[model samples]
Target: MAWVYLIVAGVLEIGWAVGLKLSHGLSLAKPVHTGLTVAAMAASVILLGLAARSLPIGTAYAIWVGIGAAGTAIAGMYLFDEPATVARIAAIGVIVAGVAALKLVS
Candidate 1:
């Protein structure tokens, strides 16, 4: 189903995002991390394409990116000990608002 594909795409997007960070800007273990990240990104694009075949582009894209953004923020805060300040939380609220607006307006 398109929803399944969308979910898969979102997961892949998060994987690629984390892989990119682990890639150390593609400096250390350049080939391995870069290749993994590239593969994950490609898989995400394919899954997204499949989802977009049925879902509206705006809606699907908003949902996909929203999941990725939320997942990444959580990972950053918990895994990387990154600051989860009020501003960071507010920015997440903005992202959620944007996704809600797209879903409503579409």
Candidate 2:
């Protein structure tokens, strides 16, 4: 299903995003991590392209980004002990709500 591909794409988007952070700008630093980051980025984009063939591009892209943003932010708070302020949490909630609305409407 296209939705299944879209969901996989979204999750891999999160992986590549966090990988970018871990890659240290994909410099000479951490070569393995950098390579893996590139790989994840490729996979995410490919899956997204597949999903786009069947789904509305706008809705699909929005959901992809929504999943990436929210997943990364939550992982940052959980793994990196980043700030978990009320405002940031609420912003995440809004993103989630928007994603849900898109899913329901489209």
Q: Please, what is the whole-model Cα lDDT of each candidate in the order they appear? A: 0.87, 0.89
**Could you give candidate 2's per-residue lDDT for residues 1-106 as a string of tens digits?**
8888888988887887778778878876889989988898898889989999988999999999999999889988986799999999999999999999999998
* C-alpha lDDT of residue 52 in model 2: 91
- Give one digit per residue, the lDDT tens place, for model 1 in 20-71: 8888765556889988898999999999999999999989998899979988
Worst 10 residues of 1 by lDDT: 97-106
Please list the residue runs of candidate 2 whose C-alpha ends up more than 4 Å from where it truly belongs after superposition. none
Return the TM-score for each candidate structure: 0.81, 0.95
Best by TM-score: 2
Record all residue pairs in model 2 with backbone atoms less than 3 Å apart, i.e. clashing: none
